[model samples]
Target: MVLFVIGIIACEKRLDEEVFSELAPSTLFTSEKGLSSVLNSSYAYAHRPGFQDSWAAYHLASMTTGEIWGQGGSIENLWLSEIDFTWDGNHDHIIAQWTIYFNSIRDANIVLDNLDNEEFSNEYKQLTEAEAHFLRGWDYSELYNLFGPVPLYKTSTDDPLLPRSSESEVQEFIEQELLAAIANLPVQAPAYGRASKGAAMAVLCKYYLNTKQWQNAADVAEDIQDLGVYELLPNYGNVFSIDNEGNNEILWALPKDATSPTASQAIDALVFPPDYPRPNPNNIVFAARTYLYDDFVNSFDENDTRRNYIITEYVSTTTGEIVPGLGDDRSFPYKIEFDPGAVGAAAGNDIPAIRYSDILLSRAEALNEISGPTQTAIDLINDVRTRAGISPLTLAGFTKETFREAILQERGWELFFEGKRREDMIRQDVFISNAVSRGKNAKDYHKLFPIPQVELDANPDLVQNPGY
Candidate 1:
């Protein structure tokens, strides 16, 4: 994707009366009580419309499907076209992402600025600042990866708008911020949703992985694994179930409170059984293109419980002939879970950001980059598969390259539809060429998403990406 500069709404210099007056600037620094609210707002931005559950997040995940949405006049169809530089101003993904990310950035900036003052004691201030930096880095890292370069905002300034930084500069800055954050942040936060040292390191690892800084990425993954706070869930199915939340296997997740409508809504209801009395645009009926491949669907042995848990034999009730149960062989494979009565609203099911399985694969990938597939790498990979109840492959037959390939396939199985396939393809250097071979309308220029035309027209200082 290309960098987009839009007319970002400026944040108020002072907090609004209704929201900020309760805690005046005087009160904000009087004690740690005022500062805790700052963290709450950051978490709120994370879950709100312009952020986490918004179109920006969802569409990024969906586009990896490489097909336009089946419905003729859908927002995602525009993304499919945009992937080939064939889209125009109506590109909702770009617009939504631009608005939400910038808004979140502004909020993070406010938090960072307020936390820098000396009113609070050094230790608490340092911890709070670490949290703010982690969030700021997270926002910039997303921008740097999806769009090549983005304006780096450190404070709320009244000066003229800044031009975008180079991608490398942005990435380096993000890495620095995460390093600072990891040092100051606690190993674990009081709440699961709050960013922790482990989470910061995980994000840092991803940043290195994206740039193909394999050695750095491996080192970071190793650091995260060394924390020992996380472990693989005994069963893959348990990881996705609502009951399984708060499981130690999850390093971090977006909090979805079912009681409060503002809390996270269950995501499965929207993506799963469409006709099961849910949202208006109920889970759009779609099948996994990869599961159709024999290597993926049948990769597991009969004893592999993950095969049954993760890949449900997806059956479309709309087909009107037969409705195979989720795990039935006749059904297709898909993630299914739904909250009835929440139409066009957020789902209650928690969206996982980092999990033990992901860590395992990251470790395997990093080790492969470091020394080909060492026994540790092979053992880690096999550990995941073994937990899935799949028969372990002989370590004697594994080579570095072969093991790397297996890890990729394993990721497809483990993290599918979790918004990672495209990044994985990009990291592996196969995104563009593979899409072209798959008959997608891709070109070398299409490797990055186009800068929305509206943004190009509005921001005179902004530059359009190559093919757009």
Candidate 2:
């Protein structure tokens, strides 16, 4: 395994020169250090800022799904309009997300293309090649989830023009790449941010669940559990705490540290109350919805420990008085609580990409789908609930349909504000209906986002998704 030294100089140099150099891949892949440098650049792409502004995939997915809403203001309105479905293909965030994921895929392909060089040791080649495949699979998974079917670039090429692949084809590609990744990756990652066998399996499991391959999803999820590399953290709130990073529950995370070049947690800056004490006293306060929806908040049992992560009211740090979270200025997510020493957006908290709890829930849902409400399924769901300090559930007499809805609701409660709601709602076939019920101008075509007008103009071969 290549021992990655944490430094920006080498990675920056590789990224700067490799993309434009005709002979860089041949020269770089011949040496272990050279190949490691290129792989570092590919890994860095995972943490690149998604949207230019505070609006990111985390915010977009939550806002569009009605789990949150942007507080209205002049600067905020720019992205909020698009997020609320008022804008179209020309939206900046839409274009930025498309660019970010494609760029990541481009970098991953570059690493993959150089892996077969004869000079590299067989073990090193296998390790680095698996990492490249994992990164590529991950990028494609994000692209497929957000934009539906995107162009499948299997190798690094100078050609920027490629037609979009079919949705099934893209899913199949992701599945095959991740399977290859799983075969070579270790059960646990050697480093904090690196992907592992468990991480690859997690993504593949989700893919199966999305495609309604119940048995495959269940089997993959079960495989992860059997690996014994991860387990749920005892405290639900501690899962997101900066001090608790690399905990047993985290399967994969984007490593963020105060000293790193990319060293901030935007979620904290985006979801804090306006009057809350922050490192910068003048920092703009970004809130979630005016409230977390009465039904959502009410769904939790009174004893649920997870409720601590959602603040409905709090004592003002400046005024030393209680503040009510109601009306337009409502409850905000406290998952990314606060880093007392953190100033501006620089916090040491790592962003979780996949967690053990998610795997458990996926297993439960998949099992339920395959065989109504089995005890194994109920036990998995109850495991998550039990961690949240709620009473365990029993199969009792639930129909297949009722059990499916129950699992969906369980996912919402467990994964809210983690950027999984929109996809979950979409898979459940309630995305449009849910939006309409919440008083949005959502249409059936809105299910797949527009292919971004800029992309359409740049690539004549590209076809836009329906309704955009």
Candidate 3:
């Protein structure tokens, strides 16, 4: 397996030609090359040891079904419960998530603070600042969405204890940052790993859509579509192939190189099967909650190719294979495989934040919300369905409410395992109660995750959410 090692140069001194201490952020941010290095470092840190755990991806799936509970350890179980949790102040998962989010924020602040210096060009500096804004906004959005009313930090500070911001305040903050980022960012990033205007738009759509500002979300999604640089990949499965790097569908992705020294094993270990005799060392996988439902299984007619691509009844890897008809096999979505190693190995696939499919779905949903499901919405949905080789829904039998349900279900089918189910359910106003009867947790107060105890202990200024 090839690993991509980010070049680490000591930034202790300016190089007329000599390299210096690599660890110091201050030294690194002084030069153009050094500044870029600092940005890469921040990216590296996002996927580093303290940031993502198996729960990062698992939580998204765990909200669904067929996921093993006891296996992820106690933290997973605590999160799975439909009630408020009171974890120890030093719970590793909480601390890890808190620290990494802030760390990325701080790094972005450093970049924004220094990008305009004479050493960098206007274009590069503008792009750098845009990326920083996107990163900061993106980090806070993550915190706010999962754990409502999180502390907000504009500039990095030595004061480790920060207080929580109100949910409205946090949402406003994300929108503001993302808007500015959209303005400064390029429509298409020069590199696969960097943020772009489309990325900003995607985040804006997510931010507005989640907050129920459907009109705003629709407008921004339309803007992204107008960019004309992105499109749905003709082949549904190719979008996730390792060889399909920088495909037009991807708006923003966390660039992953298996060979990179800085890489962490990604969802592969969790998504792929474990200990199958044949595919033994090839794709290590895990099963999660958001497996599949009978409604979904029956929704697609025999000709719908998406059903084949999105839902898998059997687990297949380079190693051994379980017979497809087995009961265990039916529960797991075999689309993606887990690479075995430690608990969470860095899977080579780049994690996509937003892609063309997201825009299409968002537009369809937004149109439904605003104009009550017009032909435009139907066409857009069918566009994606056609790409997936699914039969198009004729407007004849489709009503606004029916299309809304279809759109959401289609999102469930299309975007499953892409870290979106919880948010989708919540946005559609189905999360807090519907999921409960559906064999999942959906208490009104349980909509948002609890504030990690460590944050509260560190700062008396922070208060727990209503339920917690």
RMSD of each: 6.2, 4.4, 5.7
Whole-model Cα lDDT of every candidate shown, in order: 0.62, 0.74, 0.64
By TM-score, rank the candidates, best first: 2, 3, 1
- Write candidate 3's Cα lDDT for 1-468 as tens digits: 432223232233210112234444555668887777666555554543221543454453344332222234333454444222233334455556666677777777766777768867888787778878888887887777767777777875535567777767888889889988988888766555667788888888888887889899899889888989889999887777656757899887765544443454445444333433323354434442333444555566677665675334444444445444223334444445433332334455566667789888998899898888788888888888898777887778877788889998888777766668778877878775665565653457766666777667768988877765
Which numbered prediction scores highest in lDDT against the true structure?
A: 2
> lDDT ranking from best to worst?
2, 3, 1
lDDT of 1 by residue, 23-50 (tens): 2565643456655655555555554432
Lowest-sum lDDT 10-residue window in model 3: 10-19
Tell me the spans in candidate 2 whose CA falls farther than 4 Å from its real position. Answer: 1-29, 50-55, 72-75, 260-263, 278-291, 317-319, 326-329
User: Backbone clashes in each candidate structure, one number apiece?
Assistant: 13, 1, 40
Where model 3 places Cα greater than 4 Å from the true spot, the runs are: 1-26, 45-51, 61-96, 260-262, 275-299, 310-329, 337-345, 439-441
Backbone steric clashes in candidate 2, count? 1
* Model 3 lDDT at residue 65: 30
